[model samples]
Target: MGEWIQSIADTYKAICAGEAPWVALGNFMNAWYDYAKDQREALVSESLPALATSSLEQRRWAAFCVASVEYLCQRYGLHCPDWVYQSQYSLVEPWFHAVNPHKPQVRARLIETTPEPFTRRNIYCGNKMFANKYEFAAQAGTTSPNQAI
Candidate 1:
């Protein structure tokens, strides 16, 4: 398998092994921005479908994975795969990706700022939850893609 595919598979494995969805997604995004265009395309077309279809005991995690992948695809201007839109990939109840201590305020903020890609799948997170990694790296004075990675 290609390196990018392996990277995505590793992210899936990490999620299955009980890693936080946001953490796994952050790691995946860190690597994703460094991959070549064709490699990124390969991941969008191949790895994401496999991840979306994989059976997991935790329905919420499964939904989060699908939503995250769809969100990434949309952010990068890739055509989101049809399988991502399947009803099974959407959460029955909305998931707010924030600490529980400030429930009402967090929910209100998420409702206002969560991007459409995540909201469509009933996964609500901060607006900048999946911002372009490369842009952030550049802002932090990392001149090289490899440096960011």
Candidate 2:
């Protein structure tokens, strides 16, 4: 998880606490860059500062990331990959939580999964490889390298 991801948990807490507009424009821009996924990088890079100030505005931008997910997908059509459900949505979801941490009607969601445990089997390769050439010849009862005994 990213620092921003951790901060989203914090942001959720803050939003629940009734603080006004805890989100910043930089947060929106970073999330948008992730959402845009290279298609809007240069634009976000150049346009972010203009949108970065004011807590209310920042909060609104973050909310939009959540609110207009379907609309944006429709607007971009095939250009937007399915990754919006992955990283892009993830990056913005915290802001959505921040915006509506206390919304009882809405169920805030985040993906929490446990990875499968890794067990090393035969951890070394040499034992699995074929035996040496001489050992094979000796095992076959061959006295000469080219002739069978």
Candidate 3:
């Protein structure tokens, strides 16, 4: 992999390791989006779906990428429809959808700040849908993982 890709990979690893994850996650996502913009259809349609049946490691990496996008949306005031983060909103959807790549689908007014709202964000619990660093910072100006609580 190129140094740029490798750096993003490292950020993903650091995030899994719980080391400066918020910053690393942001960096990794920025790089991923940049690359995605270049690759366009092939990356979103072919590359991402290829991971669906890939080996465990590759699949995990794919999941990490999806999660990173969700994280960026939540943290950066980018809006996503509540459903976008859910499993139903597969990685392949963007290729077919004409929406702005950087912005979320749902308007900002509808995005709940709570970690686990009354409405389930996904088919599985928290497979996605959680606050970003800014959301965490707003609450007592501290970061606390809410799902566990």
Order of quality (TM-score)? 1, 3, 2
**How far in Å is the alpha carbon of 52 misplaced in model 3?**
6.1
Off by over 4 Å in 1: 4-10, 36-38, 47-57, 139-141, 144-149
lDDT of 3 at 108: 29
Question: Using alpha carbons, what is the TM-score of model 2?
Answer: 0.22
The Cα error of candidate 2 at residue 100, in Å, is 23
**What's every prediction's RMSD, in angstroms?**
3.9, 24.1, 13.0
Return the top candidate by lDDT. 1
TM-scores of all predicted structures: 0.73, 0.22, 0.29
Error of 3 at 134 (Å): 16
Better structure of 1 and 2 per lDDT: 1
Candidate 1 lDDT score at position 69: 66
- Please report the candidate that would top TM-score against the real structure: 1
- For residues 1-149, write the lDDT of model 3, one tens digit per residue: 33444244465455455566457655644444554434322222222233233544343444545544445456544553343244633333222111332345432222333122212321112223333334444555554434323
Check candidate 3 and list the clashing pairs: 79-104, 80-104, 80-105, 80-106, 81-106
The residue-by-residue lDDT of candidate 1 on 2-104, one tens digit each, is 5533355466677777887668766767666764445664554544334444554356666666676677777778887666677876776777878772589
Deviation from native of the Cα of residue 83 in model 3, angstroms: 8.5
Residue 44 local lDDT, model 2:
23
Give the Cα lDDT of each candidate: 0.67, 0.32, 0.39
Q: What lDDT does candidate 2 reach at residue 50?
A: 27
